[model samples]
Target chain A: MKGLLPRLIKRILGGIVMILVVASFTFFLIHLIPGNPVEAKLMQLETAGVTPLRAQIEVQAMYGFLPHQPLDIQYIHYIWQILHLNLGQSITYAGVSVTHLLLEAMPWTVITVTSGIIVSFVVGILTGVIIAVYRDRGISNALTLFSTFLHGIPQLILALLLAFLFTTIWPIFPFGSPYDAVLTPGFTLPFIGSLIWHAVLPVAAYAISSYGGWALTMKSSVISVLGDDFILASELRGLKPRIRIGYIARNAILPLFTTLTLSIGFMFGGSVFIEEIFDYRGLGYMLITAVGNLDYPLMAGSFLIITVAVIVANIIADFVYTAIDPRIRT
Target chain B: MSAKLTDRSQQDFGLSPEVACQVRDLNVTYRVDGRELSALREVSLDIRQGQITAVIGESGSGKSTLALALMNAVSSPGRIASGRVTYRGLGEVTGMRGEELRRIRGKAISMVFQASQNSMNPLTRIGAQLLDLARSHDLPNPRAVLREAGDLASRMSLDADRVLTSYQHQLSGGMRQRVGIIFGLVLKPEILLMDEPTTALDVLSQSSVLEIVRSIQRERQLTTVLITHDMGVVAELADRVVVLYAGRVVEEASTAELLRHPRHPYTRSLIQAIPRLTGDPGDAKALEGQPPSLASVPNQGCVFRERCPYRMDVCETILPSFRFDGDGEHRFACHYEEARHD
Candidate 1:
């Protein structure tokens, strides 16, 4: 316990450093691009019939920094503002703060992708073990063929196909937005029910598309594990089929740990195509608009959040994997 | 040590050194790339009651295959084509299935595998794995079972508390092998098949493990089939020795008799290959050729003919059968056994 504490602390601190590096890199990269956010906002002011000089003054006053300011000074000011949790206003959505907008949309993307990943991971690993144990059986053969077919198809295409199938062809699920617009937002059961109801199509798309990869990995892992001497020993001990499978799965699941963590990290960035196809308002949906409009602060803020999520997830994976495998615990 | 076992086996079963398990012309074959490769070619041998029988052979001699065949656990591509593995009081094990096979395997026969590092799940604590085995066989009173495991560990000279709590990787190579041995014997099986148990151990650890095995075999009256390439191990621990060459039993005799007078050329070569402290180093002889691979086994004649120092013209065309002499206690599979013995 004592030794592990120092290692855990080091990992967490390293994760923070990674998040900071990602934030600074994205911030500088977006700013280094030819177009400026202020200039784009100035054009909006000019179209509203404001004089060029006054529009320039308005942009300077609103941003609290001139376009001609030195890059280092702007970076320092940006870092200062970031430390204060003030991500500045969004140039795309007038009068809205990037931080507030990101917070509002964070939950939707988090819930959808996390739930989808969990669903896929659980179902894929279970089915993969089944397929491995029954590799020669007809049913598993059919499943392997289907999963291979699913794995080859791109996720975006799968999402769009599923959306069209469920929303237009079958008319079984709700089409657009995370929830009904008419419903009052609170902690009510109906509101949460409506929210989940609307999220079905997009979540299912993510899960079904991601399931193939996890299942294939698990099948291969289990197949290799089946050849191990411990497995034979377990069988020789007269262990029931279920208990033997449990032992096999426990060992086989180790290699999949890193993959699962990275996928969870990717979830924070969310699935943009799924969000866009279903018109579900989430970080991925916001990211597309931010990119199109070239909202620097908004884009960088969301990227920072996603990068942090991924880094923290990876750290958790390292610790959890070490905990699970005694060979690595030392 | 062996005389006591022999006398007891005769007195108890009254069949004169009663057979614990009999392998009746068990033929195990492997199909590789559409070709049938014979791994064990119509091999028949007996594991005697309350006696240690050492299956001594070089690699690829199908000694390990013989062990797996006894347990009915030949993996994919390998099939027991035709033969019977008869376990006394349990009937035939070759075609046995379901609860009958399970029951036989559970409390009747257990095997300790080679490569001790891989024989245990590294993620599980040793105690938990032992407990799991107990639970799997529906052994009642879990607490009592675990206590017995600890006692067994202590008997093997392992620290009971530390060994039970630690994972496999936490133990040294020899310790893990001991744990594997203990686990194999936890159910008190009638037949214990130990496949090269001390192959990877240091001299001290090997002797220690050998001592533990000897004591256990005596205490429980176990019918142990010990597989080894080491003639020294065979001499030290086995009561009876069966020499296999290219998937066939070349010689089977009492250990003392075989050590004193090895009939087959291959068996003589194996005995000569063993290094001795008392003998001059230059006296050690290395066998000339590799053991025949399963894929390239000769279609006719004695498999050892290619490397036999005393190869005869008839050895190239005909396979040898077991030739018994003097009360049929010692047998050698060689056409010129009479010439060689005389």
Candidate 2:
């Protein structure tokens, strides 16, 4: 226990340093984008035939967008607002706080992305194990060829193809939106079922696009691990084939865990086009709306969330490595 | 279990055999690009109980192929086409499923291969690996088994704690080979298959490992089949020697008898090639030319006819059969039996 305390403290400090770095970079990048929210709003008002001078005055009062204010003072104010959890109001959502809008959409994005990743991981790894065990066989060769072909195709193209088949030709799955208009957002079985039904096409698109890469990676890992001496030693030691394969797979799959975690973090950024295609009200949709309206606060908030998620996912992967492989614990 | 009972019944039908392992007409073929390349051709030998039987040959002479066939560890593209590898205790069980074969491996018959450094798990500690082996074989009281394993390590003149805790990557080649040998013998297996076990080690380490193996084999009365290309190792450890050339058993005799009077030209050349410690180095006769390729071997004669210095038309036309000398135990597959010399 005594030995563990210092290590735990060091890990906590490390995490804090990582989070701050992510947050600062996110702030700088958002600030670097061309045009501020107040300027865009003033430009919009002028386009609508409002007096330019009056529109400028109103925008200044709304956002404190003084042209002479020092950049450091503006950055200080931004940091203060973030510290207070004041994410500011969404321009497109009429008076909804950016935090509230993001919170409301979080569960839907999580549900689709998490389910897709989990299913793909399990199926892909199993198929890869089969391929590695039966290497050079007709079935393994066929799977390898097909997976390579699928992986070479762009994810967006795959999604569009899936949508064409499922939505246009089959007419089995709902085309867009995450729920029916009649079902309210309460804990009702019918509402949950409607949401799942609407999510099927997009989820399938995500899983199908990702599984080919995962399978290829896993198959290569299994093949390399099979070459390790321990595998042959285990066989010579009279271990059953099932047990031997399982032992090797456990060790071989370690790198995949790290890859999966990092990919999960990046999944938030990847959902933009898919969410738009499905018309889902997730953070990706919010990000698109913010970019369209030049809503700086909402855009900054979504970017910050994504950056933090990626860093945290990496840290989690490190922790998992120590847990699974004792050699890494030190 | 039923098969074991049947083997016991067979033993009861006849008196217990003196030989630990008997290979009768063993043939192994590898299908390379749809062509059957005979790796071992009608090889026959016997490993006596409580003695080391060395199969000495040059590279590509089917020494390792015989080892894999005996162990039933032949992978894809290579298979034991026809043979009876009958164990004295286990009886005749060939072409068994992997699971059934595994039941006999590491228990009744264990093996140590040439690449001992790569034969151990790098991720696992030595103690953990030993415990895994012990548990798999259902050794009683695993903690005690591990303790005994540690004791065994010390008995082999290794640092107990270091060997128990260190991974394979942390140890030297000699240390890993020592651990491998101990790993095989600790199970008290009836037969131990050693495939060029000392070939990868340095001279000092090689003799040390050989000494350890010799002492353990003597103490345990273990039957060992050692495969090597070195005649010196054959002289030191082998009670009986089987010489192979181009996948065929060219000669077989007691180590003393074969080393004294080699009948086949290949055997005679191999013995002559061994550099003497005291004799004039210039006088030693080294065998010239390489062994023939298995893919395009001749259909009608001895495989070694191309390489034999005293080859005749009869040697190229008719394959030689195994003929016993005056002593029935000493056998040679050569047309020129009259050319024998001591």
Whole-model Cα lDDT of every candidate shown, in order: 0.83, 0.78
Each model's DockQ score = 0.58, 0.45
Interface RMSD per candidate: 1.5, 2.1
Interface RMSD, prediction 2: 2.1
lDDT by residue (tens digit), candidate 1, A60-104: 544544466687886776677777777777778876878899898
Best by TM-score: 1
Clashing pairs in 1: none
Tens digits of per-residue lDDT for model 1 on B272-320? 9988898698789999988889877788988898899888988899888
- lDDT by residue (tens digit), candidate 2, B1-342: 777656663572222467777788988899999988998888877778899999999999889888888878776789889987878756664656656678788888998876766777666788887877777777777677567667778877789889988877678777888888777777778899998998778888788778878988899898999999999899988889999888999888999999998888899888888888897988788788888777866767888888788888788889988888756888988876744432
Between which residue pairs do clashes occur in model 2? none
Looking at model 2 chain B, which ten-residue stretch has the lowest summed lDDT? B7-16
Worst 10 residues of 1 chain B by lDDT: B8-17
- TM-scores of all predicted structures: 0.91, 0.86
